[model samples]
Target: MPVRFVIGREKPGQVSEVAQLISQTLEQERRQRELLEQHYAQYDADDDETGEYATDEEDEDMGPVLPGGDMAIEVFDLPENDDMFSPSDVDTSKLAHKFKELQIKHAVTEAEIQKLKTKLQAAENEKVRWELEKTQLQQNIEENKERMMKLESYWIEAQTLCHTVNEHLKETQSQYQALEKKYNKAKKLIKDFQQKELDFIKRQEAERKKIEDLEKAHLAEVQGLQARIRDLEAEVFRLMKQNGSQVNNNNNIFERQTSFGEVSRGDPVENLDTKQVSCLDGLSQDFNEAVPETERLDSKALKTRAQLSVKNKRQRPSRTRLYDSISSTDGEDSLERKGSLEKEFKQGQEAERERSY
Candidate 1:
């Protein structure tokens, strides 16, 4: 009966109903057993009182009687007293105990169902919260990726700018080095020019002193020659006067001889005096002509020396032109080097840009 009750209660909404039906069936069975015992006692009394029919065939063949009918006894159905056999009519003590047990079991089952429902609800809520958190996390990751990409682009731009700056710095440094070298060379050239100028000035001073000395020597020589010419002039004048006196005495002697031819033959002295006067006149004229020629030669020598000194002063080259030439060359070379450096730097920059792309 317990197995049949368990099998019946397997269907939906049947466990509680099956428990009530089993209790009612058990009560009916107990009432039927009591009724059968009463019927058997009456039958035994009737058979003992009928002593004349002790051997009657009817008595021997009589069967046990049922409460309602044969069908009610076989199937354990209620008799016509259906109200008496109802659950309410059964003993209250046993039914109440069974009902209490079923109530406790149902309460425990319902409490468990409530606990399961609460657990399922908590699990669903947690799942929703986790899904929201995951979405937010995915958005944050995308934002970080975008920021990283921007940073990478910025880094590349910064690197390019840095490379350009470095190239400019290198070019500037090279230019500065070249300028330094040129400046040093210019300084040395200036020093050399200064030294050459100093040497030239010293030379000029020496030449000037030499010229002064030559002028002094020439002046002294001129003075000596003039003194000598004056002395010769004085001597020639004295000889001329003596020749005149002798010539006049010879003329007087000749006039006496002509006037008195009978005089002595010693009159030859007049002819001799006349020849001495002619020789002295010729010598005086040659001395005067030679003095002018000597003076002219001394003047020519002094004029020649002055002209040489003037020429020396005019022939020296200006220092400015030499320095200008040197500076012009330096400027040209500097410009060329600057152009080459710029071209090389530009080419390198273009190549780097191409490689990056």
Candidate 2:
């Protein structure tokens, strides 16, 4: 009878180095078993009319060769004829012994394979754990880099702000210095101008006082001259009465008139006082006349009386008013005042002539 056996072929995931080695060994054992079965079948077909049996030497030669040496064969089956013996029985015995040794080796290999499988599963689990740790570490590194980028941007902005502030401070300092210099210059200029104005005011006050004194002296001189003229006129009248001559009397009167004219023309001070008094009278009269036209009789009368009091008793500052304002005069206007004063004098003379007429 022929025999066949099934061989196991595991899936790719379940296969390993040890499993492949076991498969190859099983394949070799199956081929050897098939060869032994073929020899047994051929030996059974041969016709030996004499009941012959295999000798010890042939049994030894027919036995399968093993790695160590030739082993003794076992008797497992009883021969069909008790007296008949065959060489196939010896091959069967040797194969059965090999099968027992292979079974024992297969059991030891299965236990070692089970231990190896357990170790492989642990190594795979450890590899998976290491991969997870690597992924987490990468995420941490990326997040740290992002944070560093944000921090670097902040540092750059801070540096810019610091630079701007420094520039602004420098500019402000320069501006403050310039403004301070200007302020100091202006202050100095104002102080000098004030001193000059004060000096000018002092000079004006001295001139005004001097004019007042001169006016008083001229008034007393005019009074004395008037007395002297009265005495001379009295003496002339007595002489004319004594002579009783028309021509001589006319000569004396002509001489007196000529002397008065010479005195009035030569004394410019007297003419100035006369014109000044007349100008004040004209101003008072004009104001009185205009007041009546513009106001009620009672208001006009009061205003007129007040003006008359001022004109009669107070010293006037008409000459002072004639001076150009110091504040308005740029030295050029002050220089032009002389020509203007001459024209004003001419106008005053014309007005005085009209008054005499």
Candidate 3:
């Protein structure tokens, strides 16, 4: 018998659906083999039995025999196939060719399934690599956050340090300005002090020269007075010699002449008493009287001159003391140097006078 069947075919790309379809095809083939075996057993049963295939018009040679009359020529149709016996036998070579084509399609399907399995494994590996990358990126982000926080703290500390440094600089600048003012003031004071010292030195020099001149004049006056005193002494000595000779030669001469009345006022013997005449007049009589009056006057004048010379000598020591005080170079302050030179001069004069007396 010839049969026609309708089965849904699966697409090659869907590996699971293709596998399911192949399994269903194999089940259908097994059921077909069972059906064919049953049909063959039925064809070999006893010819005497008229089973469910018996019919009133069945041919004695092709179907079953019937009791005698001339057999009618009849044509019957199978309900499913009218040409089931038309070829009378099946060809084995054509069936084998169809089976070979089915095997080639199944082999191709198996190869396509294997290629898809390989593609799936590759895709899984790519997914794993992407996940690893994501984890590493997250770790890097955390590290960056920590670094940013530390940098902010350092920046704050640096700002505080900068502020302190700026304040210190301001304080230092003010101190420097104050120091500059003090230095300028000191410099001006030094200039004024130096000017005063120079003026003092000049005045001292002038005063010293004046004192020296005065001393020179005083020495000249003393020498002149000494020479006058020497001349007066010689005149007094000559007067004494003349009077001595006259007194010795004129012993009896006073009896002829008046004793005191004949004497002139210029003659020193005129005012003499008799006691004064007898006092061993070895020097000239004029000298004895002349010395009393003239020597007294000259002695008074000499004493006054000597006092003046002593005073001048006292001033000389003071001037020399002032020189000592001026030339001092100890590191004492300017105020010490400012002591009155005149005061020191006076002190020195007093000390010198004490020593001279």
Candidate 4:
């Protein structure tokens, strides 16, 4: 890509170089044309000067004469010496010969002028071609400059975009690094948490097993003690029954002794007629009676603890209803917030559209 751009850029420079070359060639052509024009002008001026000299020579060839055309009268106006001739006797032959020479020189100069004119015309034509080339070169230069400006602008914009992309990539890389660190830390924490959870579960299982064993042993001991108590209660009832039978036999013996004493008192009544007086006198003074009364008063207080076992046979729905009501309220509030946000977003979009328009 850089090579392409360099190539593209070099094209404009090449165009500029060509323009410079064309300009230089045009300048050289112009200089040559000017020199040719100057040389042509000088040749034309020399031709004009030579023509003026020939015209003067022609005027001289037409010598001054008398009003009446008489060559003899014109020669008589001489001084005594012929060598010191009069104006009329001035030499016309040499003047005529010089005029012919001036005519020949003028013809040669005119021919040179004509040749110079031809060369000047050719130079002018070359100059015209060079001018056309110069104009085209100027156009090419302008076009190249415009293209160069466009390419430079494009390069600058591309560089800016590349810089922005690089910056964004750097930021993304930094964010990735940060996220990687966070992920590693989170992973370590998760591993530690899992290990601790495993240890906790193991400890809980061990404790549960220990408690179950203790419960089983305690239950067995309680059952054994209950059986022993029942046996002791049966032995106590048997000893009470044996003691009751012995008490009944002793009561019967006491009753017999009382009856025998009553029979002995009846026989003594017949033999005692004679001694009736005496007995009556003794009995009158010896009447003895004894009565024993026993009374017992007892007060007792007893404290007993009675336990009543009550169980709930059914679950209540009211507790579930309370939870449902709370959750429904939360859900409704969340929906309302969502609606509000959506409305706000729509309003913002509409406002943005209005601003854009």
Candidate 5:
């Protein structure tokens, strides 16, 4: 029979060496046994196969018949039986002991082979497990690399976004700074304008006050002049009344004489005409009045004309009423402008803060 065995590549070198030695020794022993059997068969085939028999006998001779002379002669032949040439008991016993020893050695060798086979199988199983574990580790490594790459990409993107946000913030800061500069300039201009406006208002107020004072002085002067004219007019009126009464008395006397005694009519008429002409000329020269030809024009018209001249000198409105409204309106407008400016300033401050952020 052929000998077959299995071994694992992962098996230890020492074990394989030991098993190889055992297998070589067993094969050599088997070859020796086969050679021995072939030699015995050839010897058996070469032996003679005669089926003849042989008997053993003894012979006596007559030579010993003389005196003590009768001597015995004996002849013996070997037996040719198969039982006589068979192996003895000692040889059979020795062969049986050797066969038992070979059987025990074969049993020990079989046990070693079985142990080696079991060890080899265990080693194969371990190798397969190691290979599987290695494959799993490799796959894990690939997955980890992919994850690391993804994390790196995410980090890069975040950095880029941060950079963009920083740039935007810088731009906003620049814009806010520019706007703040404009606001400051505007504020300065507004302050200057407000100062100018205040100065203008103050100057206008002073001018208005001066105008009012001048108007008051003029009115006072006009009133004083009016009082003096009234006094002069009264004096002139008293003189005119006195002169008229005297003229009337003279006429009455003359008229009584004409009634008592009739004198020459032409001479009295000429004297009366001369006296009337002199009285009219004296009245006109003293009073500075024009003589009215008609009696219908002689009432209060002449006196009213002198009084109207004084009153008409003050033709404009009173200073207080006119200037008070203007001053009040100016004050209100200035207050409103100040409020609007303050509001704009506050808005500018808030915008500056927002830009700073």
Candidate 6:
């Protein structure tokens, strides 16, 4: 009845029990039919001898027979007997109906057994498919676990590298700050040294200008002293000429005074005559020598003065050459200007001498 039943063992057990029970019922019915056939043959023989047969209404009038009565018939329920029944005693129609029923029931039981076998095969196939699906799911779970382990290791390595890079960047920033401070200090020192050097050069230039001014003042004073000396020499020449004319007038007066004098009485006339002759000779000698000596002295003094003047003019060129050498050390422009001034003064003196001539 239930599909859960084992087909191989349970089907055979049920078919065997049903087949045994049907065989036992058919054997019992066969024995009872044989006994009834024997009794009917005996009654028919007796009735033929008496010239009479029993009718159906007469058998109905004799009713209510007991189990052990003399006229009891064993048709529906009879004891087991080994004797065979006549074919006439068996109801052929009823036997045929029961045999057909047994054949139909056997066909139905065989069809039900075939259906159970097909269902059991299908259930076994479904169990095999479920086992394969379980193995595939377990394999997938193992692969996922391996991948997760690899990802965790990579994340740890990346974190360590990031920490090291941050340390290096901090060191570089500190080095850059120190270098910037030193560069600023060196630049400031260079600027201060340049300022001090410029100030020293300016002071030297101012001192040089003062020395040039002092040299110019000393040259002016020397030129003024030379002009004064020339004026004094001209005055000395004029006084010498006036003294020579006064000496000539004094000689004439002295000769007139000597002519008007008288002789004394106690003296001899010959002595007087000798004295006058000697006096006239001495007076004549003084008049002749004094005038010429004065003239010669005046000419000699003028010649000596002219010679000294010429010598001083010649020496001035040598003095100017020495000044030129000294002035060259100071500057070339100052030396050139001094040379031009000396040339102008010499030209002016030459023009004054030509006007006097």
Using lDDT as the measure, which candidate wins? Answer: 1
Q: Write one digit per residue (lDDT tens) for candidate 3, span 19-62.
A: 55456656655665466457546644632253223232443353
Instruction: Estimate TM-scores for all models.
Output: 0.40, 0.31, 0.36, 0.32, 0.35, 0.26
| Local accuracy of candidate 4 as per-residue lDDT tens digits, 149-228 | 99999999999999999999999999999999999999999999999999988976785565446444544543453354
Of the candidates numbered 2 and 6, which has the greater TM-score value?
2
Better of 2 and 3 by lDDT: 2
The pairs that clash in candidate 4 are none
Which rank order by TM-score, best down to worst?
Answer: 1, 3, 5, 4, 2, 6
Greater TM-score among 1 and 6 belongs to 1
C-alpha local distance difference test of each model: 0.57, 0.53, 0.50, 0.50, 0.55, 0.48
What lDDT is obtained when candidate 1 is compared to the true structure? 0.57
At residue 267, candidate 3 shows an lDDT of: 57
With candidate 4 superimposed using the best TM-score fit, by how many Å does residue 129's alpha carbon deviate from the native? 8.8
Candidate 1, 29-99: lDDT as tens digits: 46654675576466557646752222334423432431221211232432576574356555554455556
Q: How displaced is residue 63 in candidate 6, in Å? A: 58
Q: What is the lDDT of residue 310 in candidate 6?
A: 78
Ranked by TM-score, the better of candidates 5 and 6 is 5
Candidate 6 TM-score, C-alpha based: 0.26
lDDT of 1 at 108: 44
Q: Which ten residues in a row have the lowest lDDT in candidate 2?
A: 290-299
